[model samples]
Target: MDLENQLKNLFPDHVSEKVSEKKDSEEKGIWLQDDPIICKYEKRKGKPITILEGYTGATEDFKKLAKELKQKLSVGGSFKDDKIIIQGDYRDKIMQILKDKGFAVKRVGG
Candidate 1:
């Protein structure tokens, strides 16, 4: 017998709640801001890094966006000092991603 069938037989008086397969908004959805987020490129420790800042949304939303960007780019990054520092100068890729997500991005520092 299936596990659910056995459980029903053993606990006839018990009610089981249906599980929902909905994703959390914190990870799936973020608050989109009107102002353009700044995307800049800089050299640190002889390596290139892309920085994104000027997000007026909640910290959680920014963090979520940071996580998504890192995952999409398959690169390492960190959310520090209210900014997203992604390894390598992926300004084009990052801007495209943010724009696809309905965010305005401003390219800075070439």
Candidate 2:
């Protein structure tokens, strides 16, 4: 017997729910929130690094944002501890990018 037939026989009166399909991809969609995403800078080992925090989205979404930022800036970076760490200090540029994507960005520190 086919798997579907066996399942029907076992459940007897089970009704499978219909699944919905989304034609759009969420990755192509940028999520906007009320609170601004915190953009800050600090020197690590005498080198400047930009850090972005306070993003209350799925980790996958944050990682996608980080990848887009790195590609746009052509810089190396990583997502660690639920924060994004990008090489060098590109606070102004990064903030602009986020703003264009409909995310409120707040500059914090030098």
Q: What is the C-alpha lDDT of each candidate?
A: 0.90, 0.89
Clashing pairs in 1: none
Model 1, 19-76: lDDT tens digits are 7654454445687888999999999999999999999888988998898889989999
* Candidate 2: clashing pairs of residues: none
Candidate 2, residues 1-110, lDDT tens digits: the string is 99878999999899877565542354356567899999999999999999999999788889989998999999999999999999999999999989877799999995
**Which candidate leads the pack in lDDT?**
1
The top-ranked prediction according to TM-score is 1
lDDT of 1: 0.90
Q: What TM-score fits each model?
A: 0.76, 0.74
Residue 35 lDDT in model 2? 97
